[model samples]
Target: MNLLKTLAAISSMTMLSRITGLLRDSLFARAFGASDYTDAFNIAFRLPNLLRRLFGEGAFSQAFVPILAEYKSQKGDAATRTLIDHVANTLVWATLATSVVGIIGAPIVLYVIASGLEGPAFDAGVVMTRLMFPYILCMSFVVLAGAVLNTWREFKIPAFTPVLWNLSSIFFSLFMVKYFDVPIYSMAVAVMVGGVLQVGIQIPALKRIGMLPRLSINPFAGLSDPGVRRILKKMGPAVFAVSAAQISLLINTNIASRLGAGSVSVLQYADRLMEFPTGMLGVALGTVLLPSLSKANADGDPAEYSALLDWGLRLTFLLALPAAVGLATLAEPLIATLFNYGAFNARAVTAATAPLMAYAAGLLGIILVKILAPAFYARQDIRTPVKIAVGVLIATQLMNLVFVPVLGVAGLALSIGLGACINASFLFTGLRRRAIYVPHAGWLAFFLKVVVAVALMGAVAWFSQAQLDWAALRAHPLLRAGALFLIIGASAAVYFAVLLALGFRPRHFMRRAK
Candidate 1:
């Protein structure tokens, strides 16, 4: 596969999703602002989203892709198709059962996650959680189809599917709010609509590949299949391994719930911005690399696997470092310009800025985890990541305890970053010790060049931000946007120019693994 081409496809679509997500967030802030309503929505939306991460994108993909790759490599077409049907049937039943229970137990779950909630916020959370729980079921099916399509080397449709979600949320939140009388409820329903769209949009691709599964009512139908058992077995540890980030965010949210109103919203807003680069680069690369690595592993080629991982790490460092610097230096302006309308005031922006910067500091660390964890998973080594994740979770919570009182929500963001750093460190060290990933020479020099380029970019951004009059710019939305764009453009131009001078080129990243 052309790794660069695949990454480009996914990144472009992810960029669209992120842009619409920002627009949705902007509309959300304008309509609901950072209040009990938005807080409730964040909590409710997070419940299913957390599961989506744990199951849809995280554990399921980690366990599914490599095994599917193995099936494709070693089994005939008929066997592979059978495997797909069995897995899909089993997954659908599981997701539906989980969603049903979640909907029924929404209040109990809400209370545990947000004990500080009372009155309207608590009630709203329960209602919205029930409304959004079906999203988990819809998206599980979507992820199943996506996994099949990805295994078939059909990347575009699956990558593009997320756009439906953002569009659904933006449309309903903006236009459908009046029909429901409550804006958050409208948004929650839109999320369910989006989930259905996300699943529906992938069907054509799955059909085109001839891998779409027949619906089966029997949940245990796949238990008779050995492949299904393998998937279930792998899923157990992969769940914990892949859920580390979500767990950290959950911890932050629960802690923020007690810190006062809007704290959760602020962290959510900051995280959305932080995710833009991570999704575009880190996620894009990981999505492409995983299948490629899995193919190599299935072929019993450890050298190629190591080389693919190295290439991914190099690409991540190049992209994530400058992005981290840009976000950290321009956090205030970014938050103020994007989310400073309606009920989102200067105080809200101020509260969000620090967390944005703190989170940005760990952008590279988190992206590294995305790049590195697949190394273990592609080889079907789930236990290492599970252990690393548990240790990181502990370290993160400890940081939260020490920093929350001192730094507030920003401290929680900082703790997440710290955890990412620790997680990446442990993963890297383990890979080296086991000789699972052998680094290519020149990584040190390559990393240094990237660091130097980022430093220059950060300095320019910091200087530009200092010289610009934020108060004057903030008075005019267009001017604020224009100024922000100028800063971003200038910083990007400088960063790339420095890299070009340092002999970096697009072809360097595009080079085939090994």
Candidate 2:
């Protein structure tokens, strides 16, 4: 597979999903606004999301894909076919059992996740948890289907399905809220619908390629599949890294639970916004690069894998650096413009902005992992990144405890950044130690160039903030959004120009059209 083409396809779909997600967030902010209801819903939503990432996509895909790819490479045709069948059958059975346990244990989960609490907020978490529990099963299946698609070099469908998920959330936010009198729970219900649709829609595409899943109960039939065993071996450590990240989120939410109603919601809001750029550029690049890198690795083509790694890293930074600057600088305006309406009030917006800035400070670090972690996965060396992630996890908890007393929720966000920076350093250092991919000597210079560009961008944004009457803008939607857009677009233009002058070219990472 061509790395550039694959990245473009994944990026295109992820961009669409991000766009729709922004709209979904905008509507959520405007409608229910952020509150106890929002926090409960976010906590509920995050539970499944965290699990989906840990067990389904992040861990599962990282471990499963290379094995699947190796199967197709070595087993030729028939064995590869049987192997896929066995795994799918085993996965579905396991997922269904997990989902049932989750649904039954909904109260226990809510208590543990957000416990040492009571009242309406606790009630909401319980109610919404039950509402969204089915998403575990739904999303697990979607991830399995996505794994199959990615292994087959059919990434478009999997990537595009996220757009459906976003749109589903939007529809529920707009329509379903009123009927239930509580919009957030209705939004929770959208998870089940979205996940089902996401996976179900891919079946036809898989069938078109004659690679659709088949049901079977014969797990022992393929227990010796070298690829399956290979994947399982890698999965042990990948789960540590993925789970550590998820556990940190659970900690954040648990901390926020004690802080009052809207803390989690605000963090969630800022994070959703932060994830836009990260998803489009960082995760998309990783998803696309992994398979290509795996194929190159399988063929013993280090040169090709190295090139793909370089291109992927460059694109990640090119996007993340500017976004981090923009987010940190424009946090208040963004919060006000997008969320300060409806039930979401002034105090809530203020609380949300701090974490947004904190998260912004570490955006590149967090996303750098998205790029660098793939190198280990592609090379079938999950253990090293796992060790790095463990060290980062310990540091994250300590920092969170230390800072939150002094800095509040923002400190939690800041600790996340610190942890991510440490995590990336660990992983990248390990990669370098292994002589995997030594970044170009100009990496520091490239970083400094971005900082300089961002400094210029920040000046304009900051000056405009002083000049613009935020109160007046918040009072009106159209003018508020227009001004925000103008500032963002202009700053971006300036940054891009500076990068070009610094010899940073998009085409350096992107493929030239044939």
Best candidate according to TM-score = 1
**True-structure RMSD for candidate 2:** 2.2
Cα TM-score of candidate 1: 0.98
lDDT of each: 0.88, 0.80
Clashing pairs in 1: none
Q: Candidate 1 — which residues are off by over 4 angstroms? A: none
Each prediction's RMSD to truth: 1.2, 2.2
Give the candidate number with the greatest lDDT. Answer: 1
Cα lDDT tens digits for candidate 2, 1-514: 5567777788888989988888888888888776777778888878878878887887878888787778787777677777777777666776677777877888889888877447777787788887787787778778878877777778898888888888888898888888885556888888778887887798898788777768766645545767666666777789887666668878988898778767788888888888887888888877777777788888888767766777677777667877888888888888888777777777878888899999998898888988888888877788887888888788889998898998888988898887888888888778777777856657788778878887888788777766676545667889988998898888888888888888887566654211
The digit string of per-residue lDDT tens for model 1 on 1-514 reads 6788778888998898899999989988888879877889999989889998898899999999999999998997889999999998898888889999999999999888888778988999999999999898998988888888877778788888888988998998778988885768999998999998988888787777788788777788888999989988999999989887789898788889998899999999999999999899988888888888889888888888888888888888888889999999999989988988888888898899999999998998989999899989999999999999988888899988899999999999999988998999999999999998999999888988888899999999999998866644666999889989999999999999999999998887775643
User: In angstroms, how far off is 157's CA in candidate 2?
Assistant: 1.6
